[model samples]
Target: MTKYFLQKTLSQSVSVSGTGVHSGKQTHLTIHPAPENHGIKFRRIDLPGTQDIPALFKRVVDTSLATVLGANGAIVSTIEHLMASFAGLGIDNAMVEVDDYEIPIMDGSAGIFTQSITNAGIMEQTAPKHFLIVKKPIKIVDNDKYVMVYPEPCFKITCKIDFQHPLIGEQELTFDRAKNNFEKDISHARTFGFIKDIELLKKFSLGKGGSLDNAIIIDKDRILNEEGLRYPDEFVRHKLLDSLGDFSLLGMPIQGHIITRKSGHTLNHLFIESFLKNKNAWETGPTKME
Candidate 1:
């Protein structure tokens, strides 16, 4: 007899603290366990009145600078890393409480968040985990950027990138839920940007908390960060990680093969919006574990 995989949440509360990559403000975040099917939510403890924001695709207020969820004048930015951790670890439900408008940008990756969730432990709930099963091919294209989700029996992602830099001309990564280790393979991949872009972004008051400590800085002909690279294709891997986080906003895991090419947050959000509006495109059901 086969037993179905159950939905899971944190066994105890865990916290992470750091500065928001854009806000540059010190932020404290805590993840508390929720009852079965509660899904994931963010509460702004620093806000005046009610400040709860459900981490759903429909509630996503901004994608200009990280995935931002806002409601009732409360906004939480830079949440992709934390959301990635939950999705990567198959955490179905949690109540995230934050003391600032943004979640901390720890190492510009999901590594720290994954570690915290691990330390808190994962508890399985009696309810079965539901997955969004893609029934047909759904795609969104914007000039050279593209995003697509295809009907498949398992969760998988294939990402391709082509940067102008010679060092990172083109990169591709394929992640299979049954074959890939998210924590070691993708969670540690740091966000990256060109040196000139960083300087320009700083002038515009963005990436205030960005540094070598949190991101991989690339020079015109060389690398700025002495650590070199975690993986030769770390940039593409980080994009994959971000996509996972963005897709997590669907409020449940999905069973499909997601293929992306030169897509960023905007394209990712657009795809989600289209995917949701198309009623015949997907259905919810229990996942079959191998």
Candidate 2:
């Protein structure tokens, strides 16, 4: 199965323009094909630096509001959605150029990035893609939240989320990348937060660009958005989507079954760090894609 895959990247350059979620500044992003082993990197053309930040778990310097990668004194924040798009599409190497410190949270979902990349076309390279084969179970716990990964034949996730809101209670979502379409099942699901949270976030200068157009805002027992929801169980689906993106920080595709319960970006980062610390739990080499 491992021999069947070759490294892949975009066939041509593609770009998008939007407003940064945190910076609240208009931004532009461009993607270009990179060498076989180049992997995914973010270049801050707006910043005075030459070191490109690598999209890897070790480079993660912060996971509070979003997954942030820092290297060479430069940092790129809010990259989970784009990273998930690359992982779902099996893109191996690409140079992502951003004209800002943060990525534009387009619609607060991976759908836009996924569709734009598809339009740019995907091209395979000569090198076989590498994957992290899970050999044993790895888990992380944060208060009542827990995330665990077990050995499996392919990439899959079983996620459970709970919210105090009426619209969102206890919800569970199970997804297999091989059987389920990432774009259809998870990519379009937008990020969500509470109305109270938006006010509190603004006090601390977070989610500056967040609005009903980008995020699903829930106020008490009602949704603030006029257009209901894309999926009835979109809340859990978005969590699953986030988990997929966070797990991609391992720097390669993963072959395992992930079971998570109310885990967020911080916990996801901790789990990845734990898995990498245990040298015998995973092996990186040529692995087949679903």
lDDT of 2 by residue, 29-53 (tens): 9999899999998999988657888
Task: Tell me the deviation in Å of residue 86 in model 1.
Answer: 0.7
RMSD in order of candidates = 1.1, 1.5
What TM-score would candidate 1 get against the native? 0.97
Number of residue pairs clashing in candidate 2, backbone atoms closer than 3 angstroms, sequence gap of 3 or more or interchain: 0
* Model 1 ranges off by over 4 Å: none
State the lDDT at 55 in candidate 2.
Answer: 89
TM, every model: 0.97, 0.96
Q: List model 1 lDDT by residue over 1-290, tens digit each.
A: 76777999999999879998887889988899999989999988887577589999988888986889888777788889899999999999999999988788889889999988988899999999999999999999999889999998889999999998898989999999988999999999999988888899899999999999999998889988887999989999999999999999999888999999999888999999999998798999887567
